[model samples]
Target: MKTRSKIEDEYWGALERLKIGKTKVVDTKSTRFRITKDAVGREAGRGKGYVRYERYPLLCEAIADAEVARKKNGPVTPSSNAKIEQQKALKQKAISDYNQLKQAYDMLMTEYLNVVRRNFELETGLAEVKNVKIIRMPSVR
Candidate 1:
């Protein structure tokens, strides 16, 4: 299985490609969309169905930004233009907030791991153990 870091790297890379016009977002009949490469129109990410925001939030943000840019570049009324600008700002803020929360979560996880390691050392009387493995069990719903 791919590590979380690897998955996040792939998502961020795809989002960057989409932002720079290296990839394009294609909309389906349902309210779903796919990100495809510009060169050969190949799908960038995994899965056959429409991209889900819950799975790839950054990619979805990129797609929304691309759509807003497309609309702004084309013929648009003043009121609609203002709305688009508002939406863009809101999206940026949301991304910023999400990033901050993610960072906090990462820090908390690191602290938790350190505490666990210390506890293990104190209980087992092991000195300076460099490796600690954690096995997580599935939680009951």
Candidate 2:
């Protein structure tokens, strides 16, 4: 149990480096930036494309951290049925929260895609239209 707790602690620590809102620049393209674990919307630029981290990773990290804490100094040990039930409840809520976050990310991505697509179409259409002008000559004095 102690070993398991240590591993979970390490896993959680690693995940902290991958949290949402964290920004990193693309190694190859200085102008391109990647936002890790975005709960908002995916964005792309330069040579890069839109990408997002799935919520499952975050959920796993949260669960592992909680387990580590519970093992170290839980209110009760596994010998009690209530402690087991409490752990189970915590796991269920974590899963539910992950699902909700995933749904929100998906919705945001959909809106982002639609807006980009529409803008591209409009720009293309405008580009194809030929430029025209109407000019009237002023009378010479």
Clashes of each: 0, 0
Give me the candidate number with maximum TM-score: 2
lDDT scores in order: 0.59, 0.49
- Each prediction's RMSD over C-alphas, in Å, is 22.1, 23.0
Model 2 regions more than 4 Å off: 1-79, 132-141
**Total residue pair clashes for candidate 1:** 0
Using Cα atoms with residue i matched to residue i, what is each candidate's TM-score against the true structure?
0.35, 0.37
lDDT of 1 at 108: 100
Give the per-residue lDDT digits (tens) of candidate 1, residues 1-141: 634556556656655664454554433322333333221123345544445667656556666776677556644445988999999999999999999999999999999999999987775654445575455579999
Cα-based lDDT at residue 60, candidate 1: 63
| TM-score of model number 1 | 0.35
Model 2: colliding residue pairs = none
Off by over 4 Å in 1: 1-78, 126-141
